[model samples]
Target: MLKAAGMLGAEMSTTRVLLALLLTSAGLRRSSQEEIAEQQDSSLITSLLETYSAVQMPNNGSMPLRVSILISVSNVMDVDILQYTISSVLMLNQSWYDYRLRWNETQYPHHSITVPLETVWTPSFSIREAHTVETKDLSPKVKLHSSGWVQHILGLRVDSNCNFELFRYPEDDTDCQLTFSSLLDTELAFEVSYVNEIENVKHEYLVTTLDARTSHGPGPPSFSLTLHLQHTPSKTVLSLIVPSFAVLIADVFGFMLPILGNERISYKVTLLLGYLVFHSSLVNGLPGSSSCNPLLIHLFLSILTLLFISMIETIFVTRIASEDLPSWMSRILWTHYTPGNQNTGDDGKRIEAEEDRVTEPRSAQEMEQRRQKLAAGLDRGFTIVYVSFLLLFYAGFAGTWFLMECHTEARPRPRPGF
Candidate 1:
């Protein structure tokens, strides 16, 4: 009877094991791919979006957003577009904090999640007076910090339709503004402040932040974040100023070439032509402004005029040297020094003077002598005049350049009036 009972117990255990295996296989088949996928979707949506985090405002009060910028200006385009990388961090009350508090969770399920804010309770910000902003980096990075501030890092290529003042061009220093203000808020809704930001900039452009000023008026109320950009004039001097001076000097020396042939004329003409070519390049490089005339423009125009006059004078004087002296030129040029005519009462002297008045309008040999005298006088006189003019012109040119530099530097300095 004991053996029979033990055999029945073993059979019962075997039957139970087979029944468990059958149940496990049936459960695996019932859990299909579509069912698993539906479960995941429902779980994520309920946890992240629909239940807690995606609301306009979890708390009732307005959130204060403080902004700071780390800009690395790579390329400033011709269209007044600043192609730059701006590492911008906006500090505010993190939205995730409210969600966590509501759910009573110790940790967020995911490390980070991106929330796209639309035109909702939170106000938007924009660069004041900016024409447009081109977003180069695809999407802004969103992260929640332990300190309870949401951090956002973004890269933007900003196109600001700025009006530039190039009064001191090439050696110009400018304060171009990259003002950030609330698009909808104005001063009433948000207090905008710039946290003195980090800058990784190019050597050619000395970028520094200027004093903040409010843009107060009827329009969308804004504030300015001025970027004081000082162009390092080192490259400008090398490419334009030094070359310009050098060309002017070469032109001046061209006048010294023996004016016997078209060699001098041809050389000077070519030199002038070269400078004209350089001028075109210069105009292209010059910064644009509403004001038409710049200091450099005035200076260059003066130089061009002087060169043209110098060339014309070269031709005129050389022509005089080659041709016969006109009666007017002969009369003015020949100054035979004489003691005031003494009343010697000598009849022979009186007769010789009378005969001089009656003589035919000088012989060819005598005319030739007068022409040579005129040419020699011209060489001496022109040398003095030309040298004096050149000295004055160059003095003015250099003085103007230095004066412009001084004005530009002084304008940016911390003065009481400013």
Candidate 2:
């Protein structure tokens, strides 16, 4: 029994020791497993910190954004819309980077981009308002610059709508002064087309630069204009020449009066003086030098010539009217003796008949009648000759003046330097 108990105690003590060692080993294994897990967690945390540090981001919480610019211009403003578009891009730093080029199949490389923009500026006004401008007027011009990218351009779109009134008749008291404001885009390429209802006209202009403002940077823009007058026929100094020549035609008609009377002589002299007055006045009004206007000089000389002819005719008519022929001479030419009527002019009988025979009273009457007819015929002949000369002079003078004017036009004139 004793031997059996001793063996049991030894087995129990060995089991107890084995149990303690097993507990110690199990505790060490658990602690080691916990440490390994902690190490793995630390390495993961370090990796996460490294990843966050690699990315650079602004911490102020502001969003990344680019600058956007806007530009616009009026289609019908007074300034040129074109000049503002001319620009050169300045590269601030070129040494740090190499440029990359992308091209299409056409072999055109993409060094620059041309942005196409669809923008329109149109004048907004009614036909009634435009027409109502009347003496008041509104004109606009447009210009554009072809050298800038459409997208990057920035400028103001100015729509300058204004009205001005001018007096149609110079005698009228109305006068107007106009002030033009700035244009839409001070810097851009633009063009202008305008409709003037009041003027019943259309205007177009290239907007170059502006005026009215005195400054330096991109000077003020302006709309220059040239007005075209219509071809409505007007009576100028040129058209008056024909009517002036007609005044002398009246003098020609006055010469047809009977030459045997004092009345006719006075009329002829009076008409000649009137022509002299008119001719002198005309010469004063005309240019002193030779003129391209043909009839001017010809009319001057022809009238003076006509005056001379008239004065001569007057002197001849006056002398003839005052003359008295001898009675014996006249009776001899006029007497027509019928066998019974040829009576003697004495106190009695044929003593008078001897005197009458020499006097020839019937012959005298016939001769006087013949003289009157000859005088009239001579007057008509003189008038026809005077008018013929006038027409011939006019034709020759016109041809010569025209040739001279054309000659002057053909040669080039030297430029004036001094």
Candidate 3:
């Protein structure tokens, strides 16, 4: 009975000591409220100075920091140097910096404290696939939350590389990728994870075809956020295709002009020159890549060839008109223009219907008939050849362009690299 009584007294004393320690700690915490609140305004210079001090413990990711990141893309810019520029804000929930300034939630009441990100423990992080430039904006102030969440609103316009194929350009869709990863922190020192399962983007211009976060690591871990942006090609279609078709229409109509004089040649030359100017301007605006055949480039070349051939044909036909043709050759070519037989109430212009020039006629009337027939035959032949060639060319070009656009092609993905 006495031994049992002693054991009970020892247990009661242990409970009393624990209660006293708790009360004392609480009192000390209350006394340090002002000091705790002051931690938010801690000088970055001071932090940097003390960063190298020995704490008798190594700090190279010894305690793996759990970093949950969320990205909200606000703007997507143009493609330059085969890269897509993006603007976004980041929210990072880091447990390392949160508890360092812990205090009563009711007193200071600031849930978020703004601080330079490097002052806190560095995570395994970087925007992978970002275009390397001389001046990168990495000094963003991450707002640290009392609950260990940090939010940073930065406009680091990242130009991520995207592959473009131009075989079916102006009617093709472009897919761009945006990947965020960390390279400095080993997987052991930092756990990089996404706050949201899917990437969040502003849906104004580009369509979000794929939004995913991926990580494959047991060693040096990396968190990747990949988003595929699909281009509708509206701008190119409206700017390039429409204007080019208009010029093509004008060129086609030039074939209708009577080829009696220099009108047809002048029209073709002017049309070809206009297209050359247009092509040069278009080339200046297009991405300077030769991955695939550009639609405009092909069409421009075809038009140039046709115009050159038209000029050659024009010169050939003019020479034929000026030169004399054989009486039989002219007769055969102008069979439709033959006069009906005279002495049967025929008009003065209609002398006689010679039976396909059975023998070469040397009469003055026959000579005049042959000369007139030659001019008409040459003009008519030029008209038929020009129209036929253009029509056939149009059909072939249309078929090839249609096939280029309709063929099944694998959607391009941005290749990940430095």
Q: Residue by residue across 1-418, what tens digits does model 2's lDDT show?
A: 9999999999999999999999999999999988876675454334323333212321212422111221111222231112111111111100101011112323322233322221112211111111112211123222212221112232222222222111111011111111121243243222322222222223122222222212224543322211221211133234445545665676676676556666666776776676677667766543332222224545566676876777687665444333365666434434542333455555435655556677566645645565455455566677778778768866776665444431111111221110
Cα lDDT computed for each candidate against the true fold: 0.54, 0.38, 0.55
**Positional deviation of 339 in candidate 3, in angstroms?**
17
Give the TM-score comparing model 3 with the true structure, all chains together: 0.60
* TM per candidate: 0.62, 0.33, 0.60
* lDDT of model 2, residue 266: 73
Which lDDT tens digits does candidate 1 get at residues 1-418? 9999999999999999999999988887777755775675455435554544333443524653333333344444433312222222222221223333222124433333444432112334576445556655464445533333444444455655443445666566666665555554443323344444445344565555545565556665555556566666787778877887787778778767866567878887887788888888876666443343456766666667667776786676666565455766545444331222333567757865776655434533455555556555776677679778878977887787566443222112111110
Sort the predicted structures by lDDT, highest score first. 3, 1, 2
The residue pairs found clashing in candidate 3 are 125-182
**On residues 211-323, what C-alpha lDDT tens digit does candidate 3 reach at each position?**
44556655445555454545556767788878877776776677667545678778878877887788788776665443465666767666666666666665555444543
* Native-to-model Cα distance after best TM-score fit, residue 237 in candidate 3, in Å: 4.1
Error of 2 at 102 (Å): 34
Model 3, CA-based lDDT: 0.55
lDDT for model 1: 0.54
* Cα shift from native, residue 366, model 1 (Å): 4.2
